[model samples]
Target: MKLNLNKKYANHTFHIDSYDSTSIQLHNLASLTLLLELTPRAEQLRRIIIDKVPPTFRATLPKLIGTKGKPILRRLNIVQQRAVLKAIAANEFFLIKGMPGTGIVL
Candidate 1:
């Protein structure tokens, strides 16, 4: 079987040479080893994962007018509205944990 790693290594083709229940061997071990080395993309990802980069607070919640010209947020419950506001105000990352059917999106 042939395998493609990513867009950066799309030109290189890797073949499966051997396989077992535990592991699979590629025909070109050198190519696979190259993937272990860190690239610029990997470095940026590491920084973001470690929170070394500054938070991005560019997004804002949109104001949707209802049929009666009332703001859509006014219709949401206080807790839901607060959650949405918190998510919009997040700079780096925001995580919302709730049970099923809690009306929380992402």
Candidate 2:
């Protein structure tokens, strides 16, 4: 794959001409390969991290997540209720995982 740099390197302090051709080309190729390999994982992890954070951190998120609304006590089982409350109050990331039938709401 041909990796074309979008920015003008001449504008930056470091000029492309300073590096030897072979090393610069190899570095670009390695960078392109590393970026392609990690891009999806990085994006996925970003969404996961953002989602796990408290809704209060983002103004729009609370509305989307329905934090302002009254809790539907009947809809949630004991475990589900606890999980939901904990998720709302949690300062850090948390993942709720379970097998089928065991409600894991996060």
Best by TM-score: 1
Cα lDDT, model 1, residue 49: 59
lDDT tens digits, residue span 1-106, model 1: 8664687687887766645533334544654555445987555556665556754554554554223324756777777776667666776566667773285644
Candidate 2 ranges with C-alpha deviation above 4 Å: 1-71, 99-106
Name the lDDT of candidate 1. 0.59
Give Cα-based local distance difference scores for all models.
Answer: 0.59, 0.58
TM-score of 2: 0.30
Residue pairs clashing in model 2 are: none
TM-score for each predicted model, relative to the true structure = 0.35, 0.30
